[model samples]
Target: MAALRKKPRSPFWFACFTLPDGRRVQRSTKETTRKAAQAKADGWEKLSKERAKARQAHRVIADIYKSAHNKELPDATPRAFITAWLTRRQGELAPASYAAYSGRATHFLSWLEAAADGPMADLETRHFTAYRDALAARVSASTANHGIKLLRVILEDARRDNFIADNPAKDCGLLKQETDTARRPFTLVELRSLMGAADEEWRSMLMFGLYTGQRLGDLARLTWANVDLQAGEIHLRTAKTKRFIRVPICTPLMEHIEGLPAGDDPKAPLHPRAATSKQVTVSRQFGELMAVAGLRAAVNHDASKKGRGSRRAVSELSFHSLRHTATSMMKNAGVSPAVVQDIIGHDSAEMNAQYTHIESKTKRDALDKMPNLLKP
Candidate 1:
């Protein structure tokens, strides 16, 4: 019979069972005897008919996954999967992201080394829970949360590649973050103090940030090509916002830009430009400068007020506040909301004239009111 075909070289017997629906299924029963082939074929034929009937019965998910009991699965480890994932994603990730992912993967490798089992196939919630708790105990909640976040991403990739049936970290809870109540806008009085305390370079940076509402990231990368000295405007496309922004360089910013050493080669950066080649350093240096200036840190809503509130004793201020200070200052100066959003690279749904709340006349008037440190 065709169901008991003789193998050319293999000792095992192969059987082909054609179902009532005409679908053929192949099975190899290690037994060399024809009797065993017939027995195996009969059992397979029965199973095939049952599966066919079930398919006809239920149409939603037809033969999506076979029962795990019937399939020979490879033993995959989280470490192996993550290594493969990083290799695959290396080109797609940004430089900073590549560094961060590499660091997280290294940390995971260190932890995996101590495990008795070779790879992470059935990582349980308790394992993640203990890791999370250990991380929390060792570092800040935010830092610990980041480790879990990276792990979750790695596991998600593993799931997609069929390394695992489901992601174990899917529902693992992360530490809750308090609302970002960091000091963004400095009140008028505080702004004055900060401005007063700033030196030449810091002063130029502060004035530029306050007047343009540009993030330090954008500010650090600003170039003469981006500035239209003739048009009296600074034109830039923000990297983060991906929005076109044009802000009047105004007298303060223009003068500072003009006075800046016209680039060592007129092609070099406007300022030294984030020495660490990082946006974080731009803001970090700004903070250090502020501390030197004896400017008191501004109070944030989330910080412990038991020892804060006074500018001298406050612990909540970041260089980012300058952007908010500019936006708020513009609003206070009556530059219509739409124009403020436009100048700050913020998106607006309303593009129509009727919805155009901010008029150029208002921006001119508001710009006139803005204080320019270069003046006098």
Candidate 2:
């Protein structure tokens, strides 16, 4: 092969060539040194012939992108694409979902800023693995996994937008963390003490949670609109699960709801008028109520505070545990798994939309156990 030389005009080196049209052409080797450029020039000659044949098929751009997969990026930077994705997600996701996504994205950006090389296209699996390991060291597995999940979503968007040819996160193989499945049921002793220790209003909320199996988010937003006095049921259209559930109002739960402070206006909320406020406000007030109840559930004193101190026996408990308590009690009272799923509004499988097949008789039996919840 003839030796090649670097072109003085640009960093690209080229070699002299001839076309079938008898016109002269110079192929860019895009390499340095005579010998390397010469070999690259030879490869270009072969590619030129192939391109001429493939012109009839009109697949040049496809060929170029596929061959240059590692070399080129789409029009936008990774950061810019991520920002756009987040903005689009703001309108698509629920408020709680948006908060979680935004929080995770913020953390991801912080990690990227400290990276040796920026942009997702430039990242290899090693980069993602390192981030995962670092997160695992400092945070719980679930927290780290949430960060990975958010990053994966952003990268998947990038892939779809042609910002990258492939999603680096798709095969990142993050370490799986074991999740604790233990039911955090509030004991009867704990429940009785907490109820007596609290004022009437909060005591009612606690009993309502224990009986209804409704989540804190759902229970906070409960109003007279969701109750059916004639049917003796509490009707709930859950925002998180996007399902409508109607649980029969047992004596204790009904008595609690009936005794709640009510305004003269029938249209007003059954509980304190503020339960329908933003999530943070409701949670803060609930935390105060828990303290007043002599409950050991820890309140978020300061968002800026860090470090996991040794948790008290009940300190690890949260307001969310009330829902778990309800679920556990239902199971203990002979509620079928299927009816439990329906009451909790949890789909049987993560990716499946179809609910688990549960017999109606089993469901009725499970619901029958609701009144017995007062025992525990």
Candidate 3:
């Protein structure tokens, strides 16, 4: 099923073989010796014929290479591969983003358990599919979808690096969340109640959420240097999008910032507790505030024993509602969709499917039109 052909101009022998798909192809053996070149050709054809019957097709590749050249191909465990991938990616990703990636990957590995310690080349679609289904049974659909998507990205790198021949997750579709609850922006009445229930620090964070229209993680990580009281604006690069945005500080936010004590170090976080705490911790604290304001029910640890068979309850509102609240108010105030996205950091696909690059003056005017939640 294979033969060696020598080209008049080339120094190497060419292996002509038929692929498993019944198509004939030629590959440069890169060896001038007829004996070595034929071995390589024979290996390629054997791999194609035997790969379909093997669970570890990558291992089959290693076997053929060993027999042909007597050289071992490199390999890694899933845990080792994922860990190395995360380390390499740390320089390119933000702190929150890296943490999120690391956390989801932990769940992925934990799901794999004993199997994760085995060779990464041994991985199959069934392993990932089982993890996805298992995760879907335990967590919310949104969370399950995000986990699988992140796994796909991680494994995609593995494929590019020759860890695997194919990506299993590439074809594994997301779960259909028929029961997904739609998130709505906070009403002014609800904002007033939450404000009344919040402490000084939380109140400040909420104000930033309403005014800047940034995510909680970004707002929580804000520092004094990010705020320019003199310039009447806040400057910070969002963690997720990494977009450097300058949002005009409105009346209420400006008032609140002026009242707070300034820190000598520019890097000193604005909300000390929130900045140092995990996102889930800050989110829990906000949930408590919402409980006090009669916005949501308080969690009962005893009631939380609902196992993997039950899906986590979806809330119509959370701290994220503040982000929606900010966007809603901005759009309601006659600010264009582009201006809203400029503030909210939404992709054009999420908005009017159009983007207009707006100047700071145009953005300032848009913020000025938004309702002042502190007054009346």
Candidate 4:
């Protein structure tokens, strides 16, 4: 049974409940309204009852196991379980993906140590909610959502393994993400400006990006063997999508590639620094270059903000804009949608739609095809 009542010194309602084992508990509902307070009290009561049921179920299972095997079952802390799971699954995930999952799991365990005094079995939905809020406050909503999704997967695994009765993070909703309007295709003027401002190596990289319609990572890892200068084709398998594509080298890109010094090593990366540096570091370096070209504003980081590091204004342009630029340029040139999609290795028509931006001249030309109905 549970009841909601306000304490003498508190403004919010408190839920007073008793477990099936005769243990009593009192927790703040944090609801000022009576109806909300009652709902919170009911939820607490339900959770307490469920936990009691789970304890009984566990005890029965343990007794059976002990009678059959003459040994007690092993239990693990949340931290220990997550560590073991990641170790077993690391080889199954991509290197970058494994790193991201490991990082998020580490952060969650650290937060758990500071916030909760109980083991994995005692974690509730409310704890996950609090963690979600903390992450949202520290980072962008998209990042918080990503962390929440990873946490859900981890907890869901725990439930599947029978370590926890239920996954606390399963019901934790993701934050709403703002539409990405910052990334846009670079205009011809901006492209020319960037190319002029870039050094020889950067200029070659930019040319490759425009011609091949590939990501920075893919372009950076390009080897001399992938570029067939005589055949006028650049062959690559996209890292993210694993889609193999062959693109023709346009006249400008061909000229740029021919001018570059050809090293003896066929396996040498086209852009050494880009291949070695982390993707984020490479993006930041390109952002700085864009700032130098006056195409983007300079990023400023606030030093005094604790936990929240470097608040920089989002830029409308990035190295990824080159991919958009390639798609748009092809569409505007009257290339077929299928051809553009194949060149860019787009998996879906919806994704291709995002890249296509019709020019005003093309729209006008389309409109001109419609005859005036009122003409005599």
Q: Would you list the C-alpha lDDT of every candidate in the order shown?
A: 0.64, 0.64, 0.80, 0.74
- Give a tens-digit lDDT track for model 2, residues 1-376: 4335566678777777653223456767777676678787777666555534433232345346546896423334555566678888898898888887887777666777744223344554566778887777766666677778878888888767655555666656766655453337777666776666666556666776777777777776777877776777788878787787777776667666675666556556656544657776766677666676676454443554433322212243556778777788788887656678776667557423554455444544565566443454
RMSD of each: 16.3, 13.2, 10.7, 9.5
In candidate 1, list every pair of residues with a backbone clash. 296-311
* Best model number under TM-score: 3
Residue 155 of model 4: what lDDT? Answer: 87
> Highest lDDT, which number?
3
TM-score to true structure, per model: 0.63, 0.63, 0.76, 0.71
RMSD from true fold, candidate 2 = 13.2
Candidate 3 contains a number of clashing pairs equal to: 0
Best-to-worst TM-score order: 3, 4, 2, 1
Candidate 3 on 1-376: residue-level lDDT in tens?
5799999899999999875435678999999899999898999888866643343666677677667886555445688888888989999888777888999998788878897776566776777778888888777778888888999999999888878766767757788874657788889899899889999899988888888888899989899889887888899888777778889887777888888888689989999999999997898888889889998776655655663346666677887887888888878888887887887777656554455467877888888787787788
TM-score of predicted structure 1: 0.63
In model 2, the Cα lDDT at residue 47 comes to: 55
